[model samples]
Target: MTDISEVFGFIKDFGFPVVLSWFLLVRMENKLAGLTEVIGELSCNIAAMRGEIPKR
Candidate 1:
């Protein structure tokens, strides 16, 4: 079984900044993924208007 103290100790050793940075990175990645999807849709829309094949 895992000990609770071990987990807390690990977090304490690493500090809050590292954890915060990871959190921020994950949030940024999610936002970037959403932006990528929106860009893809916009590109497809433009391609349709131009009557050109949109390279996937």
Candidate 2:
């Protein structure tokens, strides 16, 4: 009960959707970062992946 109460208080002060959006954004950022890391590792594993990162 105390934990729930605390969580509710935090959510109320922060607002649910805002917090959700922030968390979602953070998750998306982390997922994108992970994907980038995997891609980088794959590039390293490839034979000629070391020429350049290439422009975005």
Candidate 3:
């Protein structure tokens, strides 16, 4: 079995890259969320113009 210390050592060695990747992922998630909100609003507007309820 691998020792816990070894795991921690590996993380310590690559922590910066891991943290950077997490930061980038979070930023991407936020941007995608904003884009999703904008798309939802646009869809609602289009549906209103067509006199139909947006698909639930």
Candidate 4:
């Protein structure tokens, strides 16, 4: 009984932060992917504006 209680107590203490961290990491990964794509697009646009790239 004490072991079960201890397990629950530990979970209560640490589970929420672990879950929250995992969720935030997943969200950040997606956001970073999107940001990376935007940065690539921006770089191409700048190069095109400077005539470093041929017009499409």
Best by TM-score: 4
Q: Give the TM-score of candidate 3.
A: 0.60
Off by over 4 Å in 1: 1-14, 54-56
lDDT of 4 at 34: 100
Candidate 2 per-residue lDDT, tens place, 1-56, comes to 47888988988988988989999999899899999999987876663555565433
User: Where does model 3 exceed 4 Å of error?
Assistant: 1-13, 53-56
The candidate 2 region of ten consecutive residues with least summed lDDT is 47-56
lDDT tens per residue, model 3, 10-53: 99989989999999999999999999999999989889889898
Error of 2 at 1 (Å): 38
TM-score of 4: 0.82
After aligning candidate 4 to the native by TM-score, how far in Å is the CA of 53 from where it should be? 1.1
**For residues 1-56, what per-residue lDDT tens digits would candidate 1 score against the true structure?**
77999999988988787989999999999999999999999989889788797555
Error of 4 at 24 (Å): 1.3
TM-score winner between 2 and 4, please give it: 4
Candidate 2: Cα lDDT at 23? 92
* Worst-scoring 10-residue span by lDDT in model 1: 47-56
Q: Estimated TM-score per prediction?
A: 0.63, 0.46, 0.60, 0.82
Q: Which residue pairs overlap in candidate 1's backbone?
A: none
Better of 3 and 4 by lDDT: 4
At residue 4, what lDDT does model 1 achieve?
A: 100
The true-versus-predicted C-alpha distance at residue 52 of model 2, in Å, is: 12
Q: What lDDT is obtained when candidate 2 is compared to the true structure? A: 0.82
